[model samples]
Target: MSILSLENVKYSFENTNILNGIDLKISKGDCVSIIGTSGSGKSTLLKLCSDLISPTSGSISFYEKDYNSYEPINLRKQISYCVQIPYLFGDTVYQNLSYPFKIRKQEVNKDKIIKFMKKLNLDESYLEKGINSLSGGEKQRVALIRNLLYKPEILLLDEVTSGLDSQNAKIVQDLIKDLNEDGVTVMWITHSLEQSESIFNKRIQIEQGKIVKEEILK
Candidate 1:
C-alpha cells in the first residue's frame, strides 16, 4: 500500500497558485526526489505533507486514511521534516535531541543517540555543547540525526544538504540512501540535479507548481 498519496492537491497564496493539481503516490521504501528551480513550490509541497499548512483544495491521505482524520501532532510524528536551514533551540545539543522524546513520553536512548552522532562524524562531547556554539554544518547534522533517531515512517526533507560542505553533504546523502534501503519512505526536495540523481531511485520534476515529468533512475 502507498504510505502517502496526494490527489489533485492545490495551494494558493492570495490569488497566485503555488501548487496545482499535484497527484503523487509514495510507497513504503521509495526514495523519491523532487527537483525544480527556486520558487517552484517544492518546499511548499513538503510542508503540506507534514501538515505544516493545508492545501487550498484537493485531498491528501496517509497510510490509506484521510490526512485530516489524524491529529495534527500524531500526523507530524509519523512524517518527520528536515528543512534547508536547521532550526536549533536555545539549549544544549543533548537537550535538543531529547526534547522530542520528552514530548512523546519516550525514554531517552542516550547510547543510541551517541552511536548515531558517532556514525555521522560528530563527537560525543557535543551532547553538552550549547546549540549556538555549533557551526551551520554541525547544526544541520544534529537536526538530521534527531529526526532519524525517532525512526519516522516517512521523512520529508527540503534541501536538507544545502547548507553543508561537500563532505557533510555526501554524508547526509548516503544516510538518506541507507534509510530508504531500510524501508523508510523518503520524499526529498533538492535543487542539485547531480545529488538528486545520485541519491534518489525516482525523480519527479516540478515546474511552476506542477509535475512536468517523472523518471525512474534505477
Candidate 2:
C-alpha cells in the first residue's frame, strides 16, 4: 500500500491558484525529487503534503486514511517538513536540538544528535554555540538534525541544501541518501538539476502548477 497519496489535489490562495490537479503516490522508501522554476508552486505542494496547509479540492491520504482523520500534531510527527530557510528557536544549538524530544516527552539523545551533527560536518562543540553566532549553513544543519531525532516516516525537504557550500551540500546529500536507503520516504524540492539527478530515484518537474514530466531513474 502507498504510504501517502494525493488525488487531483488543487490549492489556491487569495483567489489565485497555486497548484492545479496534483496527483502523487509515495510508497515506502521512495526518494522523489521535485524540480521547477521559481513560482511554479513547488513549495506550496510540499506544504500541502506535509499538512501545513490543506488542498482546495480533492483528497490526501496517509496510510489509506484521510488527512483530517489524524490530529495535526500526530500527523506531523510522522511527516516531517524541513524548510528552505530553517527556523531555529531558543538561544543555543542544544536548545533547538532538544525541542523535538521535549515535545514528545522523551529524553534527548545527545549521542545521536552529536552523530548527526558530525555527519553534516558540524563539530561537537557546536552544541554550545549561540544560534546567532552560526552561519546559514550551520543553522540548516542543526535544524535537519532536530528533524531526524525522532525518525519520521516521511521527510519533506524544501531546498535543504540551499544555504550550504558545495562540499557541505554533498555531505548533506550523502546523509539523505543513506537515510532513504534505511527506509525513510523522502520528497525533496530542489533547483539544482545536478543534485536532483544524483540523489533521487524518481524525479518530477512542475511548470505553472502542473507536473510536466516524471522520470524513474532506478
List all candidate RMSDs to the true structure.
Answer: 1.1, 0.8
Candidate 2 — number of clashing residue pairs? 0
**What lDDT tens digits, residue by residue, belong to model 1 across residues 1-218?**
98999999999999999999999998888899999989988999999999999999999999989999999998988899999899888689999888777897989988889988987889889999999999888988999988888888999998887778898888888888888898889999988889889967899999999999999989
CA error at residue 110 for candidate 1, angstroms: 0.9
Worst 10 residues of 1 by lDDT: 95-104
Question: What do the candidate models score in CA lDDT, each in turn?
Answer: 0.90, 0.93
Off by over 4 Å in 2: none
Q: Please report, as a residue range, the 10-residue window in candidate 2 with the lowest summed lDDT.
A: 192-201
**Which candidate number has the best lDDT?**
2
